[model samples]
Target: MHEWADFSVEEAGGRTTVVVTGPLLVSTIAYLDDDLRDLEGPVQFVDISAASPIDTVGAWVIYRFAAEHNAEVLGASEQAEVLLEAVEESASTADVAPRRGWFWQRVPAEVGAMVFELGRSMRRNLGFMGAIIAALLMLFRHPGRFRVRALVRQMELVGVTSLPIIGLMSFLVGIVIAQQGAIQLREFGAEIYTINLTGRISLRELGILMTAIMVAGRSGSAFAAQIGTMQLTEEIDAMRTIGVAPVEALVIPRVLAAMLMMPLLGFYAAVTAIIGGAVISQVQLGIPFLTFLSRIQEVVPVTDLWVGLVKAPVFGLIIALSGCYQGMQVRGNAEEVGLRTTRAVVQAIFMVIVLDAFFAVFFTEIGWG
Candidate 1:
């Protein structure tokens, strides 16, 4: 019948004692906060033995009042004492400030953390590479171990299915190059040189580079997503449990397929690009298809074609390995699969561009440029 969470004060010997009574629950505690804050003079003690069903919020309020007055909490029941102790512990922890170093001082720590992460990544990737190589060796020793059916299936998926899109993209790129080159060269009455420009650039660099980038975005991401999903479903673990090497059963087929098909795809892309350049030359520059072909034959060396073709397998290997590595790194659920897939594409594309730059420099130095 009485009000909950009401307090009474008694003054004695120049000190004050606050006695808290009634239910100290959320519903009643808010009304007591103002009363607690309004209490004046040095408080001797807070007696809460009469309080019923004290909760964390009520305990925290009483703790704060006692702390402000440097007053002891007396007459608390065992349960209320436990709640007060917990609140005190939490408050102590919350009051502690986190230590921080200056930005410049933390640079070394940040660099070290980055280096550690990079090293871990490299080690994991190298382990995956070693597994694939070991599997290959095993397959060579026992030819029956090869997954011929899987290999053929992946080839169709990674190569044949990709042709239309790759061809269309390369063709459009070639047309743009030819049209832009003609616009620039026409100023000097050298529009015919567009054929030479398109042929040389497409065969030597753009053809394979664009093809690899597209494959990295398409098949590479697919590889990561597929393997990542298998991992999420524990299928990879099941394969391991059954003594089936996942590298051989899953990774090798995809890697071998990509490597075998990349060169063919690059050649196809180059030819399509050349045809597109010829068409654009005829239509936009009035150079005639025969004249464009004749110029390409005379100006573009066979070594340029070989250069692009040779880079294809290496690019394919990088993309496949990057994808599979990221896939294997995936843990947890569907969101992790998506993140690893995105990382695979970005990493594969980055490596492709970096290798292309290195190839450019090496070729130039060796007179292959």
Candidate 2:
């Protein structure tokens, strides 16, 4: 027989009663916690008197149940109190907050909650930065354990596997850019300049941006999923409990691998996109291959390539950082792995675009293309 069943909380007259029947297990305690989250109002008192055979798990269940619902434990048994004490200690260590409601509050709680969350995010980032520094220091001490073969695998997966998709995407992008430029330039009888426009814009900006976005979705999410799974399985914790540092074991290799590969991928993407543009110019504008290539050379310079190449590492760093950070933060089970994976992709993509914009503005001012 499993522990805990038909768990319900109800109010009668002046007392609140939490009823549970059966032998509660760890899973049941987690379920009870969900039930506790649903409660409302200012509780005058709580009656856990009907609960039976309240062992350690049962005691944590009852304590969390009451604490989350703002209920006071009334007429508790000595065993129950002991159980509550242990649970409370754990909860305190976890930084769990008891439910508290304002009495006829003037300000809306949601607005305050938003500010609170923002502050919490800032704090989390600070903590993560400290952890990162510590991880880096640990990695510096022991450099040999990081597997070059695993890094090569990561590089292939993140960089090489993304080629076909990026090729097709950039090809379509080149077509669209050329079509749009041809339309406008043809009106001005400047159709020949379409080669110049496509090559310049693509090599300098769109190539890097598109490649970064693609990698964030593919490689970034994979990093998070891999590390998060390791975390969920306690492999990360096991590493730390031994002499190995979790960050050294997991993070540095991924970061370095991504940094090394993303630029190569970006270069491949740029070349393919230029090739894509050449195909369109060859077919649509009746321009010869040599003529299109000459025009691209005339307009796009070495600085254009340099600008895009330099941004690749930044984008790679952003993706790797977000992925490894989210991965390390994962808790519980597979659900957390999925959640952190989504978060890594989303945050990495957003940061990539933002950084792309920064690069764009800087390159424009510097006359890179």
Candidate 3:
């Protein structure tokens, strides 16, 4: 009968009745909540027979007052009764802070959890690799299914466009290596050997290793973010619904691009780095740049170049796989995309470094050291 709720208490024949009236809604509850709380009495019953269109907030207010006064509710309509009961049922205790244990116990638990998750992650990554391999095989069998345009686009993104930055980085790194090596070797009157150090290190390790890291940070993160956005937008699902395989369309091209482009990029990086070292050689070491460049062939063996070339494609494969795998793992929300993108870059770099170490050991054992 009224837009706002109001209550009045009546006493008759040793019984108290708190009569509630009007539309008890969220927008109107505030008008009478303070007044209701101020009343102190042995309230026996809360009569809402005149209350029209009660909302959850109104039901909650009435329920709390009745409970506090040890009074019973009366004349609540079916919907209002259901709302009151639902609010009552929803109440519960929850921890205000995270649970904790003693330091020693907590450390072990955390370590165990980390190890378990790492193992689980490795298994999942292996499964994803297997799936990619199967998809590649299927594409090979049905050559018509392979996406050439996508592959070319990824190659441009992963390799061609990256040349300027990678070249600059390699150039600076080479300069640093030559400059630092000259500083240290000057002590033994072996300054000329800076060429050997610069050539060998750039070709055998830093060139490809740093390139892989760059690709992981750049292309890998981009892959995760792009694919993750597609996933969130349900474009991946749409692809599946329309009989287009996501892996063949999205992942394969990227993988192939990285695999094909890394070798070229690695070689390019090494060449640029040597030019950088040669500049330092001419400027600081008083050796002619062209002479220093020519000396690299004689001082740095063919095996060093082979080492970089061999490792390049494998590193690229790991980086691409990490990116695509983490991207595909995205679900639920936008936050997941960010988390997966970071994971992709971190996972790619970590795997690349680990693989580089393994390759080092393997090559040394095989007489390529």
Candidate 4:
């Protein structure tokens, strides 16, 4: 069924009339545009009356032809006339959308957008920190408003439930460090220094760092998911309506729990790691386990233990704040809950690592290395 469009030029009284024939819809007139554009028609009028059931595409082609030849469109029915007029009006000189630029041009624009987003994120985080501080002040003024039960529950979740996994990770990491250190130091006939490497690294850095990473992955993600779900269900909105501050009811307890438990957890991880190091030293280096433990006391300073404890609470604060802030930012749909939860975990871990680096530099300068 070929109902393709066709046009015939007829000359009458020194005038050219293009008699358009066949169905004038898009599918029929597909090749008509090139034919119309290439046509040189100083001779005349476009007569579309002979055309059957003309659509916008046909109208546009005919209108373009008539305009190029300075001829009037004639013999058009009401429908064809309406379409011609509409097409004529829509061929605007103004740009509807900006055209894409070259790759070099796009790169700078993309970089600027990313920098702007980073700045906006920092400002929002700072504002959220202020809100948390203000909520703390409110709770301080009215001590009875504190939710002790929620705080206890969060403590158990973030600390007690997390213990076994944190212990296991630290243990494995200690074994690796001890075994690796012994192998390396054995070349120099200094294999006994494996105890020093294990004890000092675990106490000063690895224990707290690994614990923070785990907590960020676990508790931080949980905070974002829980709060984001609450936001989706309008539970947060309901609390606000009932004159309850979300920060006080939900955030404070989690923040407090993390802050209180992190130091204890970090110390526990360090001790567990030390035990692991002892196990490795006894097996590989032929040192007695009790002797390895006793050596750790002499080689590792009390200052290393203080360093881990000092950093724990600060890391906890950052992780909790990042999670709660991202959770509070969630909006629109159920998919937003997952997105925000992921962002919370990523942001917490990134900030934790960055701050850890800064602390390392600062503490080393202050002779706490």
Candidate 5:
């Protein structure tokens, strides 16, 4: 007989006991209630003395019945326990298989989501660009509402406030560069030309690179944190509801200001770095300040200085765009704001370095480097 084809229940003293006398497979469904309701008993006494032959499916049915009734299966036959253990192990393996597959699928889903977000970001920026053009046209027509105060204040904050730190860092960097060059040049009796090499390299590369990195860390982080805070507080939504454009109020101002200020900052870095190399030349190479300055002036052209300055707006755009994009992606939660702020700074720095490389290669190809 099938282990599950026939079953008997014994009720005594407010308890139920079940025994299997036939095949215990799909046939168990015949007796199962439609709803599988009230299938639980306080204690299930299995009459293992019968030595019923049950398969894996039969054991699964028995386990399910026992669980539904919140009952403990007593008198489990040795064969029944062995069958049930295998069934349980199979179920566990099944569970883990799906989880492993899900982990792999999750990675592709994350990539797809990022691509979707990028498309949405592009649309948002395009809309902002339209509004910017419209505003410029209006400014040309009316020639008013162009507040120079805010512009000046922004320039001062982004440019002047950042100057001292940029100056000091560039100075130290220049000294190190000069010292390194002196060592290598001295070996070839080309020590005097070290000033020219250091000056030209710093003006064309180090000054701009250092300044961009600093701004990415400072201004980009501030933009992200500020916009993220506004997002968490729903200030951005309020502006939209009140007929104010978030881009005009937040993005445009910051982008314009940072772009305007970066060139000035790059200039400051270049000048300070030149001064620094001069100091190093005096101390390390025993060259007078006048001679170092003259050599630097001869090798480093006005165009080299201009090259660093020209790259500033592109770097500033990278910083502002990365920060703004990350900030806009922030969800309305404190943890999300903090996370996006960190992402903004990191992405800005990475993009700046990447753009700097592009600039370096382009300049070299054009005979500027």
Candidate 6:
């Protein structure tokens, strides 16, 4: 018998019996552990009829002792038997090994998975582009299918309403450029050349690029979220069910609006930036407005304006397509909508920059530099 528990061993008819008593709980687990460890010799059976309120910890201790001794349990109540069975099942589960590949072997597996994912993404985007193109062709064939009212509304939403913020951003960018150019040119005794710097940079690069980026962040994300929400609510599915093409109805208006308005926005941005540059030149470089205008006329050619203008519709198309594609890709829930919206903006901006770089290289090689 142990001091902490009513445990004893008895022999009857050459069979050894171990009796357990008292509460088998967390508080007495340590005592149970010590008693269990002291138990030696072959035990045929363990009696737990006297044990009260057995728990998982005590069940585990008693079960392990019986397993090691090849002993069967005797006189256990229903609660004790349930706990012991649970412990036995848990022990069996714990014996299984966790799966983990070696580091060198995992590298190729991870790389292959990434490649497969990339391939799938490319195929999906290509299919989406084909669908959009087909929808546009169908609309062209059936001119009456065009939704003029929706297009106008989207134009107002994507273009006109975006003017103030885009104008302000471009204006501030122009001022900063003029100020920086003045400082740099003044060091070389050529402060008047700030007009040339601001005009060339704003018309050739900054104006349309910044406008595209802004639209991607603003209207592109809105398109994604709107379409994604519609998809989540099954409105998109309903449209298809009612013999309405979702791409023609939902995507075309936004795409056309972006394409039609982006060039206007870019032109507005360029003009606003030039005005801001002229203001800065007047204040900081002591150049009059007419002189600044004349300098821009002389230094910045018409081709520079054309370069920025040409990029506008392409950027708009990229933004709209990316937005609508990601929106269509949305599945399952609200969280997916938010995630895809963010991805749309990011992808649109990235593609815009990449296309801009290509244009820059092409134009420079063709003597537009």
The best candidate by TM-score is 3
Error of 3 at 342 (Å): 0.9
Tens-digit per-residue lDDT, 61-177, candidate 1: 999999999999999988899999999988864436767889997999999999999999889878888998899999999999899999999999999999999999999999989
What TM value does model 4 have? 0.74
Question: How much lDDT does candidate 3 score?
Answer: 0.94
TM-score (C-alpha, index-matched) for candidate 1: 0.76
Which residue runs of candidate 5 sit more than 4 Å off their true CA positions? 1-98, 102-118, 124-143
Worst 10 contiguous positions by lDDT, candidate 3: 90-99
User: How high a TM-score does candidate 6 get?
Assistant: 0.75
- Tell me the TM-score of each prediction against the true structure: 0.76, 0.69, 0.81, 0.74, 0.69, 0.75
**Residue 300 of candidate 2: its Cα lDDT?**
80
Segments of candidate 1 deviating more than 4 angstroms: 1-100, 365-367
List clashing residue pairs in candidate 6.
none
Over 131-228, each residue of candidate 3 has an lDDT whose tens digit, in order, gives 88899899889999999999999999999999999999999999999999999999999999999999999999999999999999999999999999
Error of 4 at 312 (Å): 0.6
Residue 100 alpha-carbon offset, candidate 1, angstroms: 4.7
TM-score of 5: 0.69
Clashing pairs in 2: 3-23, 3-24
lDDT of 5 by residue, 1-369 (tens): 432355567888876776656555555545543323454446546554453566676677767666666566666678889987787676542454554447679999889999999999789768656766676565567655454565677667678889889999999988888889899999999989888877887888888889988988888888888888898889999989997667656776677788988888887887788888889889888999988888787887888887888898988888887787677767858999889889988988898888888988988899886
Clashes of each: 0, 2, 0, 0, 8, 0
Best by lDDT: 3
lDDT of each: 0.92, 0.80, 0.94, 0.91, 0.77, 0.92
Worst 10 residues of 5 by lDDT: 32-41
RMSD of 3: 4.2
